[model samples]
Target: MNEHDLRHLEIPLPFAPQRHSMSDRAQERVQIWAMRFGLLADDAAARRFESLGYARFSAYWCPTASFADMLLVAEWITLFFVFDDLQNQAITTGRLEDYDRLRHTALQVVYERGVTGPVPPVIAALSNLCTRTFPRNSVAWQRRFELNLELWLIGHARENSFRQAGRSPGPAEYPRLRRDASTVLPTVDLAEVIEHTELPDALYFGPSYQEIIATTADIMCLTNDLHSLAVEYDAEDTINMVTTLRDHRGMNLSEAVAEVRRLIDVRIADSQAAAQSITAEMDALHLPPRIRNGVRRCIRDCQSAMAGMELWDRTETVRFTPDEELGATRAIDYNNGFLDASELGRAAPADSRRV
Candidate 1:
C-alpha cells in the first residue's frame, strides 16, 4: 500500500453528519485505564493538561462502550483534524449537535435500559468504558483538541460560522459566546467547553500514542455504522438507531442495515484506493516510525475486534424479547472493580492479526 492509502486508513473522509474531539476527562479516563493495565503510574501527564481549563471542564469523551475501540476513535478524531486543516475549515455545529445528542442519549439509554446502538446508528456507549476507565492528558493535548472541536463548530454553524480561516476572536469574546453556546448546550456552551480544559505545559507525549488512539477511534465509529446495516435500514422494518433515537426520523431498520453494510464496503474500497495518501503525509510530516507502528497495531486490533464481534451472528441480534442482558443502567455491584479498573481489565484483543 502507498502513503495516500495509508493516510486514508489513518484518517477518513467526513460524512454528512459531523464528529467532535474527545473531552479532557475522557482522556483522563484512558489514563486511568492505562494505570489499571500498568500503562502509566504518576499524574505527570494529567497535571500538564489540568492547567488548561478546557481539558478539565468536560473531560475526554466518546460515544462507544468498547475500550479497545478508543484507539480507532482517536484515529478518527485525528482524521477530522486532518480534514479540518486540509479543507482549511472546521466542522459544522449541526454535525456536532447531532453527535452530541447521540452521546447524551446513548449514555442515558445505556444507563436506563442497557440498549447499545439503539440510540444512534453512528453513536454508542462503548467508549464510555474507556473514558470512565482512562482519562485524557490533563490540559496539554486535551485542551488543544477540545478547542479544535469548538472552533470546528464556529466554522460550521449557521449563525457563528466564520467566513475565513484564522485564530478565534480572542479571550475577551469568550464570556459572551459562552452564554450563547449555553442556549444550545446549556451546561456545556461552546466557549465554556473551550475554556474549561487546562492548558498543557510542554507538549509531552512519550514515543507516540496519537496515531494509536486516533486510528482506533475512527475505525470503531465507521465500523459500528457498517456492522449495524440491518438495524440502520429505514426500509427493512428493522430498528434504525439514528432515526428513532436522535432525530426521530422514521426509518425502516432492516433496509437501513443493508444500506449501512453497502456503505462500509465502499469505504473499504476507498481506503484501498487512497492508501498512498497516508505515506505521503508521513513522508512530508516525518512522523516517527514507531508511531506508525502503533497506528498499525491499533488498526490491526480494531480489525480483529470487529471481526470477533461480527454483528452478522444471530446471537448478536436484539430479540423482541431479547434474552436478559445486563442493562447499562443497572447498578454495578463493584466489589473489587468498583474502584480499581484493573479488575475488569481491558477487552480481550479483538482485532485481527495484521497480515
Candidate 2:
C-alpha cells in the first residue's frame, strides 16, 4: 500500500445517510434503564460514564423506530456498552479467566429461562434483554442472536489472549476478528429486532442479501475504527484497523487511517449495490405485500444504522473529541487523554502497545 500523509486529514464522508429524528426521551430511557440494570459499578463508574456520553451514543444507535422499540434499542445499546466496558477491564487487568467465566455465565442466563438466580449486573441485564427480545421474535432469530453473542464474547476472549501475549492481529486476520470483536454482527441482529421483521431465511441467506449484511457490518466496523482511532491510540489498544494496517502492512499511521477511510467508502458502496439487488429480487418474487414491506424495512433499518454511526462520530461525543478538548472531568484512564497526529511519533510500535 502506498503511504499517504493523512496525519492531519479531514476526509469527508462518502455516502449520503438518511436522517432520523432523535429523541431525548429515548436517551433518558437508556440512562434510567442503565441504572435499573445496574449497568454502572459505582458512583465513580457513573461519573466516568457521564464523561463517555453513552446516553447520546445510545440515542444515535436507535433509529426512528416506534417509542416502544426505541426503548428496547436503547436498553440493548446500553447493555452492550456495559458488557464491553467490563470485558475491556478484564482484558486490561489480566483477568482473562474471569472474563471467560463471566461470559459463560451470561450465556447461561440467556439460554436457561428459569436460572434467574443472582448474577453479575451485566449478565442480569443481558438476561433481561434476551428474554424480552426473544419472545416476540422467532426461535431461529433468537438462535442467530445467541450465536452472534457467542462470537462476540469469543472474540473478546481472543483479544484478551492477544493482550496478555502482547500481540496484534495482521490485516488478513483483523477483519474476521473485527466482525466479532465489534458489535457489527449484533447490530445487524438488532436491525432485525428493531424493524420487527423476521426476514425469511431464504432471502436472508441468499448471496445478494448476505452481501448487504456483510457490507453493512463492514461499514459499521470501519466507521467505528475511524472515529475511535484516537481514543484507541490513547489507550494503546491494537485491535483497530488503523493500528493493524500500520503494524502488519508497514504503513505509517496516516496511511493506515487513509486506508481505513477508503475501505469505509468501498463497503458503503457495496452495501448500496447489494441493497439494490435485494430490491430487484423482491420485485421479481412478487411476494405478498406484508413480506415485501418487511424486507424493505429490514434493509432500511440497516441503512439507518449506518447513517446513525456516521452522524454520531461527527457530533460532540466524548469518545471522539478534538485535541483542544482535553482534560476530562472524570478520573478515568481509558481514552481519557487528548490525542493529535503529533502523538504518533511518540507512540510505541504494535508489540509495545496494550489496552
Candidate 3:
C-alpha cells in the first residue's frame, strides 16, 4: 500500500481504547528506570524513547492495573522494544552469533530469575525484572511466562536465520512464526500478572482459551504489519504479513493489504466466538463466579491490548517513522546503581528506588 492509503487504513478492533489514570507518572518512572540502566544513552536517546509513548501503550493495554503494577508493565514494554530494536540490528547486520548469544543470555536470565555475574545491561535489566515479577505469581504461571518468552526468543532466531538465507517461510508456515515473533503471548501473560488473576491450567490450556489467545496474536501481528509496512519496506524487511502475501500469494500491495484486513476480521470473529463458547462452558459447568469473571476479564483484556496496540501505532508511537532509528547508538551500561537486582522488589524511598 502507498503511504496515503496506509495512513488512512482502518483497523476495526472491537474494544474501546482506554488509558490508566497514572500513565504520565508511569511514563516518568519508566524513563528514570531506563536511564538508570543505560537503556537510554543520553538526552537524545531518552527523548526518542519517550516519544514512543510506551508507558501510554502499557496503560492502554492494562487499563485497570494499579499504579505500582502499571510501573512494572511499562518497564516490561520498554524492555521489549529495546530488545526488539537490538535484535533487528543484529538481523540487519547478519550478526547471527551475537543474536544467538543475546538470546541465550536473555533466556538464562528469565529461567534463573537472577544473574550470577556481570552481564550486558539488557540482560541485567531483564534479570532484575524477573526477580521482581516472578515471585508474585504461581509456579504454573511462571512456567507459562517462561515458555512464551523462550518461544519469542526462538522466533527471532528463526527470522534471523531466514534473513541470513535470503528466504522467506512459505505462507503456510509464516503465521505460526509471525505469532511467536510478535511477542504478544508473553505480553498477555504479563497482563494476567497485572490483573492479579491466574487461570487454572485446565482452563488456560483448553481449546477455547488457546484459540482466543492465538487469534488475538494474529490480529495484533497483522495490524502491526499493516501500520509498519512503509517503515519495514524502507528497511528492506520482507517478513511482514503484507509482504508475505504480496511475495507468496501473487498479490499486489493493495491486494495484499486487503487480504490481510480480511484475515484480521476473520480472526476477530474467531476470537469472539471462542470467548463466548468458553464463557458458556464455564457457566454450564457451574464454575465459581470468580473463575468465570476472571476468564471474562482475561478475554476483555486481550481485546483492550489489541485496541491499545492499534491506537499506539496510529497516534502515539514514533517507531514507524524512517528517521526514528530506535536503539541506534544506545549502548547498555550498568554503572547507574539502580540496577541492583537485590533492591528490585524492596520498598525504598521514591528517589532511591523504583521498579
Rank the models by TM-score, top first.
3, 2, 1
The true-structure Cα RMSD of candidate 3 reads 5.5
lDDT assessment of candidate 1: 0.30
Deviation of model 1 at 77, angstroms: 16
Which sequence of candidate numbers ranks them by lDDT, best first?
3, 2, 1
Q: Mark the regions of model 1 whose C-alpha exceeds 4 Å error after superposition.
A: 1-140, 144-254, 273-276, 309-355
Choose the strongest candidate by TM-score. 3
Model 2 scores a TM of 0.83
Error of model 3, residue 314, in angstroms: 1.1
Best by lDDT: 3
Q: How does each model score on TM-score?
A: 0.31, 0.83, 0.89
| Predicted structure 3: lDDT | 0.76
Query: Mind giving the per-residue lDDT tens digits that candidate 1 earns over 1-355?
Result: 2211211122233321111244444546543433443222345533422232222122122222233344334423322322222222113222443333333433332233223221221112223332321233343444444443444344334223322221233323422332222211111111122222321122112212223223323333344333333322322211222222222333344443344345445545543333324455455556676645543333333333333223211222231111132122211111111112231222222122110
How close to the true structure is residue 274 of candidate 1, measured as C-alpha lDDT? 39
